[model samples]
Target: MMSLAYFNGNIIGIDDPVIPIDERGHQFGDGVYEVIRFYQGKPFMLKEHLDRLFMSAKAIKLEIGKEQEELEALMLELAGKSGLADADLYVQVTRGVAPRNHLFPKCPASLSITVKPARELSHQVRSEGVHIVLLPDERWQNCYIKSLNLLPNVLAKQEAFEQGCFESVLVRDGMITEGSSTNVFIVKEGKVQTRPLSRYILAGITRLAVKEITGEQGIPFIERAFRPEELLEADEVFLTSTTSEVLAVTAADGRQIGDGQPGPVTRRLYECFQQKIKAM
Candidate 1:
């Protein structure tokens, strides 16, 4: 089975010339997106992802015309066609095509759903842990919305990529907010902490799942911002996203994080998260 995509309600090969140049998403970065991960064949936390998608659309005043069920059906159809054991549904909705303008486009919305195989996280990183860098958060204030405007994140991640790192933790005003493309968490004094849901961070789906796990397993959890300096002081640090899932950060900016290994808390959380996936 080949990779497939749903463009404007029609399922087609991902390589097809379906998207227009003037699409608001392409021209002005006026769109919202979500990535749904499927383990085996079942999409993990699909409902939660879709709910966030709706919330993101509302944040940007973009109307996705299709009903929720209709959009879900479309994604299901494309995922079924892809036939990958582990894959991601890269779904986006834009303000349709229009002439160049800074204002909102007065047209229906456009949607694109692409299914691609999910690349497994590197074994070295998963088993031991990965190193990351802390970068100043230069993005807009609306990081809560998963919009297509990702130049800042792209640049930051690219810097990490060049530095031979797995990801970049973004700090704003001396506080650790999140990663360039993921939500960050740290274990300090045996307590799990991540920045609270705010305009400063993206509220990753996997992050919410981890939060639920911390509660179900009675792990100490706190939803408050922590300082960048505190990251090095953490006992363990991990990142979460649709693609990265739960990834440990053993170092940042060449400084060892938490004894230079995936600490007990991160490992246990990952194990419980795996069991949660199986139950799903």
Candidate 2:
């Protein structure tokens, strides 16, 4: 499988040094991004990803310089060039290359895209489930925006990794918000619950898919805030993202959840998720 990249108007190598030092995205984390996954050479939800990309750009007052359809076409072209049946398409838009300054520059926005092989978790891990640690959410208030300011997330994820965990569940205001890079969910009494869409958590595409799946399956899906304690006491805990479609969390903060294994509801949801992917 080959990887491809596109910067501005030209397609280039993945690691090419095309971005200047003064670029807003390089100097200051002044940008927005999206990660869309293509399954069997077909994007799972291209329009939803593009809509979120534009929404993030608008949130940061960054003009993407290209319309939604134009950007979508460009991403598709780049993904096609990669020649990979399953790929992760990353799109980043910044405020262009200009002298390093705190203010926005009067220049066109920079659009960069890369298509790489899709990463999947090992079957062993998926079956056994993964452990996670609860970390404080030190990120900015605008977590809803898919901005490039990810230092807090990086740190939390690294901490979890170092602790022999798969991911870090972030807690804000004594309540569980989300994972370092995934949306958190809990299953209790045969019902699913997750945090509502707010300025604190992202409106994840996979999370939306899970909501729809629950509806179609006659499963109860509730949107509300829950504390870390509630998460630990839940019968099953799971996470969702573009990459981690439906991952079960068997432990958190060294405490075993449920039977300390992937629960029936989580497995059922994952099976349903795979079916959805197959249907795509």
Candidate 3:
């Protein structure tokens, strides 16, 4: 089925949605974006996603053209019109269109909203877990902002794919920062540890939810910078994202991660995450 998108102020076919060629987002990547998931026709953690979106825009000095409540209502309306009970809702706000220049455009900003079916991980990958590869972190310092500039992430992900891996676990200096497009976590002696929110990584909404879920389940959770050596010694490793949700990492750079299987702790959290979605 044809997908739908809300461009500027009009809801139209995804392929036909229009944006000015001089839009700052297109020219300078001066925009912030958020990806939210929907289940049973309702957006999951809608408020949290919106909060992050606003934060990202503020960090980059980009203005949201509309009110938060209005944007939320519009997203839900578009999601409903897309006819997908479970979907990925994407929202992007750019500095708008103006004459070609490096300066912020004087025109009002443009907003784009698109709702597409959520693609869950393959059953085999979910059951057997994924294989990851480590790569040097080549991104800019301000990784906290969810900006449209994704060339570094694209390169890392492409390298992983070329090497027959599902994702790239990024390493900076000697510590694990995050994945190319997701947050990284590890299990050690029954405790869950992930990188603390910093300029080195994006503060993932799913990562935060995972922390809360683990806490509610009485699982130990820690936020700290983990060395690459620590990942090798970890009982289990996984990734979290708006679309990927929770995915176990069974291998890294062809090295088996804890018997080369999805560890019990990961399975437990995966089950809990599924339940949370159903409840949502």
Candidate 4:
């Protein structure tokens, strides 16, 4: 079956869903977006994703153009129409359509919602983990805002793919920052260490949840930047995102990371994460 999308309140095929060329999101990448997953027809962490979406929009001074509750209802409706019980929902709110200009247009925001099947990680990738290559961070400083400007990430991911890796691990100033589309974490001395919440990285919802779960479960968690050399010496490496959840990085630049397998701590957190979603 063809995928369905909800563009400005209209249900349409994904192939032909329409957005004006003058739309600021298309013209200048002036927009904020979120990707939330659904299991059994219900969105997981819907409230948290919406909260982040609003935070992102506000950071750019763009209005959401709808009540939070109304947006949630509409998203659920779109998910139902798409007939995707297990999928990823993509939603965007742009500064709206207007003549090409750097300044914000005097108009209401334009909303776009699309639903598609969630691509599950290959069993090999999950079980054997994946390779990653370090790249210099070239994104703007305001990476905290989940905006539509993703050229840097795109380039990094493309580089990783070309290098036979699964994801690009970004390093800024010799210190590991994050993955192209996920948060980076390292296990050292039986504790989890990750970059602190800063203007340099997006505060991933899954990242925050994992921190909480680890704390509650008595797993030591630290928020701080570690140098590339430090990451190389760490016991295990992993990346987290809304969809990827907690994924181990078994190899970096052809070097094995802690026996070249997902470590025990990562597996424990992964199990805890799954339990949280099931309980939801």
Candidate 5:
């Protein structure tokens, strides 16, 4: 299906004009955003995504001005109109249009949303695993907030591209924080470990699902910060995100992770993820 845009209360063509040049989101990146994915015409974890979107708005002191039910209704309607079996709905709420300044705007906040076809990662990426590079985590402390400011993340992805890698494993002070746009996890001695929630990590929705799966299946999951070297040395490594899902990270810094292939644990979690999406 072709793409479309939902600017505030109006739905229109994707190329149509909606935002002004003085929009706060454009001027100062004073906004929060969320990417909600649809599977077979149903949104996966719609409630969780909306909750996180509001949490991000609160962290930025921005008011979305719409109740949760209202937002969800509008989003689902847009998704239905998108005409695609699988798509991505991007919603962003900004502090509104105002003159360039660091101070908060006196105007009411504005919202914008768009629905586009989802890009499916190659099955080969999951079957053969993928390589990633190590890059220093130079972003702000409030990584938990899904803000519009992504300059550092963009650069990190660029570094990974130059190195012929799928993503960059971001490290802060010798500890693994996450990937450029994903949450990193490792399997060590048959146990799963990922960094605990903090201002340093985004606390991904997919990460939550994996942990829950581990718990229900008695897989022994641990939430703690593991060093970069530890990730390299783990029996298996993987990254999770809204779109990427459970992707195995085979090699980092030219060194093999585990047996240089997707491990049994990673494969099992990925299968569980598929089941969850199907049930949705």
Candidate 6:
């Protein structure tokens, strides 16, 4: 039941003030991050998560100063040290500490990591399902990159919370993009449809898991864009992320979805996802 943190090469308290004010990640949001979940002390899809982390760092033109295997080993070592069987491991790579400037600094990159207990959704919420709010997607065009620039997402999530909703479904150009922190999916006629991978939406690992489950289960999985109206009209809707895996959305903007309950298709997918975890 302990939370651990690692800054640079030293393990420290989770709330340690080791980062300097001139750090680019603190000053300019110049960094990329990843959150990997451990189930029963085993990391799920760790290679895929690391691949995306490197991709995000390259997209930001920030050298991580460590090989992929090296970073992976470090993360595993830190998680083991935390002694938590189920945990959320957050890894952040920044452009390093330097004088205040808009230009890149000639310094080594900074690495920060934290391992905390997993934040599992309550059984009541998962069984009963959750509600969401539709909002305009105001983020930059590079939503594919897992960068530290999350002010727009934070604002949208806060707005949803104020409206007594669990999440915010964002729309861009009249088509539903994604949630502030999850991938959106709609089920119609027993087929699952989600927005395709693009610069406008992130390629979520949990979303990929759902795709694999649908394939193995012989369920139709479509990667195509749909409008808000389509989502409203969908027989069922759900969201996926590292934390909220295969969560059902029972209502949107106070409107009931699919008899206002978690649908059969969603439950099937979620059960398959849990089996995937068990086999991991």
Using TM-score as the measure, the top candidate is: 6
lDDT of 1: 0.91
Q: Tell me the tens digit of each residue's lDDT in model 3 across 8-121.
A: 889988888387788788898889999999888888899989998999899988789788999999998899889998888899999888988987767888899888888877
Best candidate (score: lDDT):
6
lDDT of 4 by residue, 1-280 (tens): 2357887768888889499989999999999999999887889889999999999999999998899999999999888887877889999999998999998889989999889998789888878888999989999999999999999999999999999999999988888889999999999988999999999999999999899899889989999989988888789999999889899999998888999999999988989998888888
- Candidate rank order under lDDT: 6, 2, 5, 4, 1, 3
Candidate 5 lDDT score relative to the true structure: 0.92
- Number of backbone-clashing residue pairs for each candidate, in the order shown: 0, 0, 0, 0, 0, 0
Worst 10 residues of 1 by lDDT: 1-10
Q: Compute the lDDT of residue 154 as modeled in candidate 6.
A: 100
Q: For candidate 5, what is the TM-score? A: 0.98
lDDT of 4 at 251: 91
Give the alpha-carbon lDDT of every model: 0.91, 0.94, 0.90, 0.91, 0.92, 0.96
Which residue pairs in model 2 clash with each other? none
- The sequence of per-residue lDDT tens digits that candidate 2 reaches over residues 1-280 is 6999999899999888898888899889899999999999999888999999999999999999999998988888889989999999999999999998898899999999999999989999899999999999999999999999999999999999999999999999999999999999999999999999999999999999999999999999999999999998999999999999999999999999999999998999889998998998
Is 3 or 4 the stronger prediction by lDDT? 4
Off by over 4 Å in 6: none
State every prediction's TM-score relative to the real structure: 0.98, 0.99, 0.98, 0.97, 0.98, 0.99
Lowest-lDDT window of 10 residues in candidate 4?
1-10
* Candidates 3 and 6 compared by TM-score, better number: 6
TM-score winner between 2 and 6, please give it: 6
* Tens-digit lDDT string for candidate 1 (100-217): 8999878999999999988787788799899999999999999999999999999999999999998999989999999999999999988999999999998799999999999999
lDDT of 5 by residue, 171-243 (tens): 9988999999999999998899999999999979999999988987889999999898899899999999999
Which candidate model has the greater lDDT, 3 or 5?
Answer: 5
User: TM-score of predicted model 6?
Assistant: 0.99
